[model samples]
Target: MDAAWLNPEEWTCSEGVQEVLLESRKSSTRLTYLAKWTRFSRWASERGISPLRSSIEAVLDYLLHLRNQGLAYSSIRVHLAAISAFHLLIQGQMVFSHDMMVRFLKGLERLFPQDLLKDFLYKREKGELLIQKSKRLKNNLLKQMQLSVSKDGFVHFGDTVMLLSPENNKSPTENYPAACGNLTLAVNPDDITVHTSESLQVPCGLSAVKSVNPVGRNAFRILSVEGNSMGEPIRFGQNFGLGATGGFTDQMLYLASDHKSFMRFAKKSYLQQVFLTDELSYLTCWQATFLDPQLRLEYEGFPVPANTKVLITHCHTNRGLAVPRNYWIRSYFGKEYEVICHTYLDSHKAEEDKNYWIIVTANPSDDGITMFDRPKPPSEETREREKNELYAGT
Candidate 1:
């Protein structure tokens, strides 16, 4: 075989074809293609192989070599384009169209989930995609309506409502809903009752708490082991549980003590995920502490008011829950951010705004339930009236 195939300058192309090829692409692109083609030619020559008659196995090896050299998925595609163009010019063959080559590229994409282009692509499994869409639809329906409340005139224990951020409420013109955090927390085991693992902790799904809307996964039913507080006001510093409002699994927010589960940035603090365990241990409890951004202690031990900013710190770690704005993860719903529990200083140092959350009640009118209203049982007069009415009907 003539070594002419190893060099673009020695290609046995006619003058007319060469002129037409020059007109087909910009000078910059032609130069880039030629440069990339030269690299491949040199690799083939080192092995004493013909570049024009390269097999699928040979091309795969070359692509893998590029990947091993730290070339991104997009960069690999550029090399393929150059090789494909030059190979067609000389051999009139489509090396890139081979089934194996196509599959190899797809495999590369999956192997590197952090690829820049993967952000805009749908990388979730088919079943997960459907589940995400269904969850989104359910959230939309919830947003169209109000939350479920109790009769205590405040968001009582066990009331289900969406946790909205007060950050957007400060500026009417800003679109903060797009940056709202939604829990991607899930149960550790699908069936927690039958599971026998003691170290089983609830783990956050591939997606964190980041969400575009403040409903569905954002809705949670306030719970507590204190059954006496069921109809009472949800007070501050009280250990409570948060069960995700909509889902087949009983996913409740829990702070995993396992060192392996801590956030990468804040290693001392735990990453906030969901637990599916039926046990009401301290791990699943969190406290709505009264540390206001303004440095006020006026609301300590008071009922958690609606639309009022409050700090939610994990009871186990005493670290405040936060969502790092810069760190993001791709999900079936879209790009989402990670939610973590950070050490005291990391959570509240000058950036405490990220730690502030509002408990939005589902009540339509503000007069119906005010946080100032102290929860009380029915009065004796009202009880007597009810008794008389029952006797009269008998």
Candidate 2:
């Protein structure tokens, strides 16, 4: 062994190796080779050996170490190349014999399926080619589309057309052909409808709501309720303002467009179905009822089969303060009842009063029905403010 080659000072860092490589190859290729060299240098340094003068026996030892560490066969081959290159540069002789290289490559072929490796290589090469082609095409297209402005402040493209202003030059409906064989169009937000109700038909000016274009349309209405049951934050008379159109399906909940009624299929509550009974003929009209999967008629208190048609409704989770007796009477008598007029007087507020009116129709008759109502009020400060500002100003 030559003592000069074993000198630590003579050996270089992987970065230095890359600097030398840059003189002969492209920067990208040099960087890749440098990465491999760095790994080899680290491995040799850990073993107290000079990487540039490492012997064939040392190479075998490094390969065994890599295998013991669970490195893949392909990675080991890459390491072998780096080690061989380092030794050749320093010792002026080849470190790996042709037979050894062949054996190493054969081992890699066995460890990784040939089909998998071939596909990986094919995709890697194809990606590079595609990127290069895309760059060239983009440049050509940009050059062809470039326009020049004249003394009249009009943009001209080879005398085809004159652009008046920046806004006029850009067409709102221009369609660019895509590789997927579809024309991608530009849309104007002002030309489409974003929000509307089920009762009020979406205007024709907003008919392009379904179009898939930049600014084309997003015309679907959606309402998201945060409670487990339909009754909490949304009360009987509350209006759930529709913000968009066309997104609702059947059974989807909504406030009445007229803002007077809360409509939902009766029997939609699981609690009502679980408690239906025979003796209780008149179910609560405020609570909805429905037939369960077992073909059993169900209501708030009695899930029974008494050969009776029951009128079911929905209840808010807060539990109404007054189970209006009229609600039960209409359910048993099968007659419509007017919710003449009701008032919500918050005890917390002395001067403010809010009232609501409703008309309900119920069917089926039995007995033992209960109704309760509690009066709640807003703050006195709020009432005073409303009187001074809103009502007084009006």
Candidate 3:
């Protein structure tokens, strides 16, 4: 018969063939069959034959062509299975009988015996070795990201600035006076000198003594209070910064936390005017009617909220964290203060007279210890009062 006489549309129009095609459409198996049918049709057209009238000899020849193209044996098997299913639908029985299908499958198995055996063995293995190795590498990276603070007011681990309060561990007498005095600030791994102080000690922690030479310049500094006065877990000696700076930015990039928390400074009047509420965290943008009020800023996103308090801890780069590059603020709160910014850190040191800040240190290497946000625990009296109210049903 002239194979061209057997039209594909005619074959599809057959009662049982249409039903079989419809059933296949609802499954992945049907999709595979349709793809194989397309390839078979193309091959038939090249031979001037209708695919429907093509003999088993033609199918075998197509399979040989696939083998010569170096396709995986498993892929070839899927192609054969798809073609055989179509044959069964048209013939009303297994077109390649069960015995013939088995022989074809056996031939594929022989073609790539080692690969097939390896695939089988890999599936049987209790755990995926590659996955386990990947997990281990991730864990190691997390460990490397953890920030470490030392007792001597040195902050280490990632790019970080240590903001120390004299009150952290010292008596009132040990605290530095608010008045101007000689102070030391340090820079690290290179230990490059910036300033010299006659009164302050040299090689102090990770910082060196720097003399504030306010020559032909109006240098103004301000002290600020930080942390939740509502009695959160902020402890003494915790390192904090005023704004994002270079070194600290590098540290943050390495830490790679899912979220970041920082206190920002706002104009004093604005802070007083804005309504304070728990849900304020959800605000994307708001205008403050008040002026010059210091606002406490906690940034979960960036540009760190206009005029908010900023901690000088190293945050990993937003780029490394998959955040936008411009997220870090160069200047904020109408202040020209520099905030430490980086992907990693070594050691951090805090200057007690500078500002009070806190650090919430987390070990990224630790498993099953993700940071969580919850309401502060109620006081004992508050808890008892709540219990009493519940019992009274009022």
Candidate 4:
């Protein structure tokens, strides 16, 4: 970026100090770029393709080739940046600035992630493309992690973790796994329990090795978890099961207050099954136990999570971290209910409030749409009344 390094092609012998500095920078920059450019050239030539004048697909194929070689994210960035610089050297600008190219680079960061939280767009079973929304919180950049890039470059997005971990960002260099807000942790009964503060969403991994079906446009498999023998439809069931009972329920709407014992575990320092959070926007309106605020006299319907869940297992060990946050609230129609537990494994996080909704009843109306009441926290006066009542009763 320096003026002296601008003309990286300048190869010269100099006697003066400034001249020597300029030459050294030029040589170093040129050498570094030349090596990367040559690699691309050789790669293209081997495949009988052009490097600089290549099409977007060609360039993407080259990137995929590098990715298949197990390149680190930083290293891959350097390669692409080098290509951009190469084009700038000849064309006085960049070749990788197209919208498709930009998306390709952006997709690389998520498709090939440095941590647990990932984002990308994938085509669903019905041919609808869904974009997964993921946030890179501050916790992502502060962990001590050692990444193992396998030669196959195949990352497992199906891991379900129960991290009852504290929000400790003090150690930036500890050998730990990168934390994402949502993850698909393996719920094995034999694995040792790990307690961390991060509960990442790991949606279903659709592969030929495992069961896969084209259902929702979301990025996960719909596992129908039930309460009182309720279940949701899966791709396999929808396509194969003519009258299967496990595949007919909805994945978005949750039954509130079905599990009343959630509050008992909420207060424990270690037990964190039902988390009390004020961040309602993390999920769709229908996914919340209370009424959704987005509903209006002007608007037509409510929103829902891309994925949803209705039940979870309460355990004392590491499995507790995998439990979804449960909430009990009153609907606008004056009905009291609790939203079902939406664990990280449930694809509900991917469910959008647009068009789709969670129908919590077995026999919903012709239209499963309904209005909800706005939610409000308990007032100070109410808290005082409860406190006084508790003292008086004691």
Candidate 5:
């Protein structure tokens, strides 16, 4: 707004000072740009937009307005140059020289190849194009948390109930593991305790993992199947059985394949009797392993922490357990998504992938060892007792 910066009186300062000042005021076209700056200022002031300190959105809106008024592309650049010079003189920042502004101009060039203004006016008048201002909002950046599970933690065999949590960007009340509006990984119980017999199905997909409506008690039990079965602590990289611990009938989850050549995408999961000495029982065994190198280095062979993301690998198929978020089906428990076992190894992106599952331990007790706890060394009496027990076994 100050024309004093444009025109100057005879300088009586030192020779070097006058020379530097003259160099700074070397723009001969400053007088021509004055009218452009005045027009922008008037337009901005009328629309409640500050000409001195305005956002990128405001600048974009002004450009759109210029295009709508049938201004030539060269004329628009001249106006921008004037605005840039005005901002540099007043605010000490060349706004149009920003990377975003440069990219925007390039994008406009590409989008409108020939007669940018004329084409824009034609399209806009014909109702084929419309420029809508985007509302300014905060970015919802997902945060990551790291934790470790120890041997004596709450992840016990056939006892501890847990929920598979997914990262949610929703509100705090209905977030991860609390699937109020979204699908939750659950098994449909054949026998309904609360509902009458007529309402229930006799032999539904048992232990079948489905992304069903969350019934609050949708949780699974982790059972150790490798060494010291059922009663011992479940460890990472060790074989285990996952059972739907929700309703009247608890079934062990396993991957079932139909001898199809396209088994990678076709292998569906089911719940059945895993402890029985049948050929299909081996499919029930699965292993939990870390997908991250840092996590594996620190927590490998250790008990997997509850509410932490880990890879669930099926022992029989040697494929990772996955829930295809796109595949939806109508189940006895309403609309549900399908779960399958497939090794995501064709691409190097498998190193950090969707195969990761969050296991959230339910009702964690105070006495149970947690991921934060450090293991204490055994005393002399404990060592003597262990030696005596070994000697007796021998």
Candidate 6:
């Protein structure tokens, strides 16, 4: 009966909570609260729970979800506080006012008794957190970070930045602990079949011969697909002087060629979560990897990139091209990422084996790949294909 209950502000993160966030914001509590609230909304939507009408029961379900996701205990308590605060802002009362909420959190404290106030950090399901401190703590942490970097080239800042769920979070190797970015994948080096038969075209109208082979049709798709961050525009199918065509540059072509040589490119796993701490220079290697953003590769039933696309043909053995290849697409962000496909979960590394992901922040490495300039005449095959295509269009 009260129109006040129908107000949109009752369910949104707006002015109502703005002052509260500022008033009680801690080292990074403001960001933590905002992020946790966002995660809450996302979790609610996925399960068909309405923000405006979600009940205490739903709050419990979310907590269970976070626990099932391996979030740290302290992180969970913070999230619990965030949820309670959010509800107070929107609903004008606490859905979690029940003593059980307090009791549950207290119980968790008994189990995971890590001191949140003293512990430098804790990781989360998605983003990372660097709790700023009273200049003293901040300087000490930075010194520690710098020391680690000097010793290890770069340190996987560990166990502090907390995410709501690993299923929903995917950061790169850098944000994790010392064990991330393990170069050796599950594939046996002996199983890596090398094919010395194909040629990879580069932008300079020249080609590089690759070693790995795929039995699948070498049907290539170089159409350059732009992503969130658009670098230099890679023209499709044009000889840009040693770059890839159709967005497929020499690096991509080389990887695809390797896939064909390996007999079944799918058998060998390429590098994932690569991070060279000392090198400021970077390059992204687009090994011929493909992903189905939804069906098999969905993260929490949502596509990881949510913009995954693929192109392939039904010709060739598909083996030469590698039927089910799983290589880390090192080109997306600077971090190497093995696309998580439902179909390949069994073959993927154990949770600890792979890097603790939070999305990539570093640029790609180019030690084994190349992208460039300098003109050369297009191959006769390219010229002929264009000629034939022009005539066919007419």
Top model number, lDDT: 1
Would you give me the overall lDDT of model 1? 0.57
Q: Clash pairs of candidate 5?
A: 207-271, 307-359
Per-residue lDDT of 32 in model 1? 88
TM-score of decoy 6: 0.25
Q: Model 5: residues >4 Å from true position, as ranges?
A: 1-154, 168-183, 188-217, 227-231, 249-280, 293-299, 345-347, 351-353, 363-394
**Steric clashes per prediction:** 1, 30, 59, 38, 2, 59
The true-versus-predicted C-alpha distance at residue 44 of model 5, in Å, is: 99
Q: What is the lDDT of residue 113 in candidate 1?
A: 61
lDDT of 6 by residue, 1-394 (tens): 2222223553365665644544544647657777888899898999899854687678877887897787776667778777765563333556555666767677766765664433334432221332222222223212211000112221122201101001222254544432122221111111111111122212111111111111111112222222322222222111111111212123332122212232322222431111111111112122111333243333222212211122111111221111121233322112232322111232342222121222111112332111011134599999999999999999
Worst 10 residues of 5 by lDDT: 133-142
Candidate 3: where are CA atoms >4 Å away?
Answer: 1-21, 24-28, 88-92, 96-98, 118-394
Which pairs, if any, clash in model 1? Answer: 182-209
Global lDDT of each candidate: 0.57, 0.32, 0.34, 0.33, 0.52, 0.33
| Best prediction by TM-score | 1
Query: Model 2 clash tally?
Result: 30
Off by over 4 Å in 4: 1-26, 88-93, 115-394
lDDT of 4 by residue, 47-102 (tens): 89877666667777877888888776556666876676554333343556766777
Candidate 4 or 6, higher TM-score? Answer: 6
State TM-scores per candidate.
Answer: 0.43, 0.25, 0.26, 0.24, 0.39, 0.25
Better of 1 and 3 by TM-score: 1
